[model samples]
Target: MSDTVLDEWQIALKQKKTELEKCQKEHHVESCLKCEKLLNCEMRETYVKAVYDSMSKGKGGGFEF
Candidate 1:
């Protein structure tokens, strides 16, 4: 087994991903795009933020993509 530890941002991203998946399961949808609340979902918003934070390592910056 791997003994690697997750840092704060990764931990938060993991948590948000779990919550997002749970919501999807409860809604019986495979993707968030299939959900009606795709636009105004707080869960999705937080999850997106968590993803960005994870990519940026908590550093506030814009990507060049």
Candidate 2:
């Protein structure tokens, strides 16, 4: 994939992570349920892992396998 695409995906993943965190913090179980379900979804994880893997290859982002 192109760097621009990868960057966009990375930004999206970060946005999703932030949304999930907000839902969890606000005690929005329903929101969190949706977020958790998405996070656990195969496609979502794939994207997340791709971004994490790329970041991990750089200055060591501390992502656990």
Candidate 3:
């Protein structure tokens, strides 16, 4: 959270819908263990946390369980 530029994952979070969908389509990010884009992506943890947090808080989505 500084003046430094945001990384790919941070940028993705800001564009959550498109970014997540694109990753899913291209890499099957959640299901693909051998995902190339995700294998070395530095934003992996932040991306996952952002997704789960969004679901639980109903910020961008919802979850029943």
Candidate 4:
């Protein structure tokens, strides 16, 4: 078992990436959607937004993990 503990940002980023894959269907992120905490998920709205912002700024699109 790996002991790697991902920080809040990393976790949020990973979740967003996964969600994006199913919802957005993109490895990277061209456009980010609002979370609004409607789902009452662990990832906060601000954190999700931050990840979305980072994904949008990435060079090109569809950044595979």
Task: Please report the candidate that would top lDDT against the real structure.
Answer: 1
By lDDT rank, best first, the candidates go: 1, 3, 2, 4
lDDT string for model 4 (2-54, tens) is 79987665676777666655543332434444534336644345456757556
Pairs in steric clash, model 3: none
Better of 3 and 4 by lDDT: 3
lDDT of 1: 0.97
What's model 1's lDDT at 22? Answer: 100
Candidate 1 positional error at 3, Å: 2.4
Off by over 4 Å in 2: 1-6, 28-65
Off by over 4 Å in 4: 24-65
Clashing pairs in 2: none
TM-score of each: 0.93, 0.36, 0.32, 0.36
Predictions: Cα RMSD each = 0.9, 8.2, 9.7, 10.8
**What value of lDDT does candidate 3 attain over all alpha carbons?**
0.60
TM-score winner? 1
Q: Residue 9's C-alpha lDDT in candidate 2?
A: 51
TM-score of 1: 0.93
Clashes of 2: 0
**Residues 1-65, model 1: lDDT tens digits:** 97989999999999999999999999999999999999999999999999999999999899787
Candidate 2 per-residue lDDT, tens place, 1-65, comes to: 55555455567667767765665566555544456565456545555565675575444457566
* Residue-level lDDT tens digits of model 3 in 1-65: 57888655555567765565566677656643557766666455556666676545534564676
- lDDT of every predicted structure (CA atoms): 0.97, 0.58, 0.60, 0.55
Candidate 2 yields a Cα-based lDDT of: 0.58
